[model samples]
Target: MNFRQKNVLLILLACFPFGLIAQAQKKKSKVVTDPVFSAFSYKGNDAIYTDNPLKADEFYNPILQGCYPDPSITKKGNDYYLVNSSFSMFPGVPIFHSNDLVNWKQIGHVLDRRSQLKVDSAGISAGIYAPDIKYNPGNETFYMITTQIASGIGNMVVKTKDPLKGWSDPKKLNFDGIDPSIFFDDNGKAYITHNDAPDRGKTLYNGHRVIKIWEYDLQNDQVIPGTDKIIVDGGVDITQKPIWIEGPHLYKKNGKYYLMCAEGGTGGWHSEVIFVSDSPTGPFKPAPSNPILTQRHFPKDRKDKVDWAGHADLVEGPDGKYYGVFLGIRPNNQDRVNAGRETFMLPVDWSGEFPVFENGLIPMRPKLKVPKGTERKWEQGGYFQNGNFTFNEDFSKDTLDFRWIGVRGPREEFIAKTKDGLIIKPSERNIKSNKVTSTLFHRQQHNAFEAAFTLKYAPRSATDMAGLVCYQSERFNYVFGITRKGTEDFLVLAKTNKGETTVVASVKIDTGKPVRLQVVANHDEYRFNYSTDGTNFQNLGGTVSGDVLSTNVAGGFTGSLIGLYATTGNDIQPQ
Candidate 1:
């Protein structure tokens, strides 16, 4: 009885081990075969087709998307670098890099340090204005010239070894004017050009439409006196007409220095013109084909409808496509003003050795050769819902994809996580403050979108509050949060826009230990729902009212953002 039974039981136990091993292999094979595991690939190996013939699906072109104004692009070999106006937004000069012009990814901000730029207290449009980017062939370095909009007369220069990292401390050029550009000549001379008055010390006598260029001594790092000359003066030219001239970029090609300047205004009616001369200090003649690009007069179907275009820069792609990155705005077509100005790229066309553009057709298409792979692209809006954030029970380290950004700018202090959950720390100030400290937030870039989040918050102080936010700018943002005020819990709704954020709703937080907050936004309307328990939700209210701040209002050249944010307004000490 003992020997036979023992042998049979041992065989059965051994069979169980082999069976478990086979089942484990089958489970692994299933995961490898799953569409979500493979289709959610980042390699972009899969190819899919879009109705967009213009290749608009790649790299979130309109990369600067809405109103990311005064774009400056510098190309270094196959790598392209970009920077934009962070006006009033902290962490100025947000820099990005793209190997393929169509697929851009932000590496890190160049002006993360406070010494780099100063935007005092996010007031009405006062900060880094119109940055111009250039590369030197001799030294193989990149440089940026930026204006302090509120400060008036001084412009700063910051250089970088890598465009992704922090830039050198700005070497202040005490020269008075705005829209400054540095032209690096083949002869190894650096020249600075900016808006200068024709008649100095005289108020009405000075023509505002004139732009002057002068040989600058970069070795000494100063604007040279008397070396300056008026390159383009609108007071003289009549038939070859242009209204406002600013944001100049100088590049020499084929024995002529091309002076490219943005005209009209940044408003929806923006335009750009190019002039050529044999010298950097030019008694320049307008390009045989003047006004190389202008969106002020797009076709009936092409009109952006909102004002402001043309703060542009020319970057030669790795494939040698001469591309112009410029900013334009598309109205939400809603009664409320959509303040976002969309950025567009059109190839610079050379007609008879001069740049020519197809009438009002600023090419809004991607130029990169589609990578040789299966084309699979994800839509910005969800297939089932329209929100910025998505969450699930599957909380792996991999659940957080690349779709998150910190408010004002990104910082290590703003984010943290464990295997269990994600946590965001409250920054001391609101978006309007100079501290660049806002509850860390990411953009809600879609017109119709939904954002959802699942989190547990443990606040040490009554002022501690963390939740999801749909923010257009400092003044125009709405947040849904569970805050601790004394022993009482305060559910808050803060509505801000047009330099004012009125607390529209504040109610007693239900006492059952508030843990999770979910806010869903569709178009301009927002709905707030909360859950003390993960399954059940309470509708707080949609009575909160504010304009969906776009490029038009937030005052930056960026789109609206919806992301996780935590705030402790004025409760903590300044940085």
Candidate 2:
């Protein structure tokens, strides 16, 4: 009896362990099958299509649309390269290439690596500001100088032989200024110009700034000490008490050295003023017709309005015609701007010794002549003809297109491209957080447009949610997502203004099927809707205020963006 009992006990012990292993395997499989997932595919409406065909003799203003402001253009051989300021969004300093200057295409970003930039804790519109791109034909290299304001790096310069591939590591310059620019002279010497606080003393007035110059030693990769000199104090006219004499660019044309700068700040008083000097540094005289380019003189009651036109850089076109690229904003009647400052182009007419921007104060002419022999494909030339169009993203491709941008630096772990669709994991940081969040978005290219995406998401806890957002900054944004309250799930629309979040609308929903969330932007108002099925959508509740997302209310230098985001709100992992 004892031998039989011992053998039976051994069998039971081995079988009991096997039974437990089998149960654990079954639990793991359940977790894998019921994993938290969400899918989104979007397409815009193209009903209000404009039939303005691209003409060989004429082109449109805003050669590059959207939030591409503070442009710095440089020419290499027959090819021209341009870059714009990218504030807080990572992959900063988006570079574009163009042959005709009218039709342009994005080459890549200068600061593509997280090591090359530091914007993790940067506030909105605080990362990179007013980058100036230049090509040194003597050295056969390209240099880009910019200010990383939020990173507290002052002005940094990055150079490369091939800008399309990538740029070199940033060399933090020992300069105390913003909007730093580099000018290469005919003598192989390099000069850097920027705007800094006058004399570095105590505060005088709000906008008391000066344009200073320094001799930069390229071989040493630093500015020579004691070479720092104030070139223009208090802008073109010290009596006017001009402010923000920044974005300084130096050029030598027809035996005259011209120093151009953006004056009167970046608001309604913005303007471009120029001065001529015999040498790169020194007794520069302001042009009689000062403020060569500005929209300040244009009446507010004009039929068409474009304000804040300044921060200009001049480039000679392929046909030897000079053109200026500058930043301008179009504000609604409420003085709220949602599109942010965009890059605009105007013809430059030489007046004796200085350049005068044509069409001064009047609305920019929509039609202009392209350079002769300038040829472009149909798809590349008509970027601005139709103000709006449908953008369908299926996420079937292996990599995201260049139009997509991530906040701060992109966290690769938060995004996964699956065969079915894109899979995004919720980060601890949400859109409203000042810290960098895991969100990928595109610019709100149009003021009046619709954005919708279908997502299959199931939040396990009240802290987990995934959906769409129209983000302006950490302090101001709108979110529409499928959120959980206890065990129940609801589709919610919320707005965050000045760090205060308020739920605008919410509707209880079944978690059994996918949800389609849509946002329709009509001027300064936005309407949010959701649907179980793709065709029929039910409006959540009231209209969300879009003005709060504007630059006037949000107080940033960047435009709003539409994106898909997920946030866990805490460090807890999804079930």
lDDT of 1 by residue, 1-575 (tens): 69999999999998999999999998864431100101010111101112223343333335444335678888777778877776655566667666655555666566666566555444535677888888887787788887876544368888877775567988888676788989888888889888755555433322246687777776766778878777877522544454567888888888888888877666655677788788888777886545667655555344224335577788765545567777765454343334355455655665456665433344333323333331213243221111122323322565344334443344555655555555555676655554555354444444443445564554445556666566666666666665666666666766666656566666675644434565554445656776667568776766443354654445544556554656666232101
- Candidate 1's displacement at residue 533, Å, is 4.6
| Cα RMSD for candidates in order | 13.7, 3.4
lDDT of 2: 0.79
What is the Cα-based TM-score of model 2? 0.92
How far is 23's C-alpha from truth in model 2 (Å)? 6.5
Model 1 lDDT on a 0 to 1 scale: 0.59
CA error at residue 507 for candidate 1, angstroms: 5.1
Q: Write the per-residue lDDT of candidate 2 for residues 297-390, one digit (tens) a residue.
A: 7677664467889999999988887889999876654667877888888888874788999885566554566776775443554333224546
- lDDT of every predicted structure (CA atoms): 0.59, 0.79
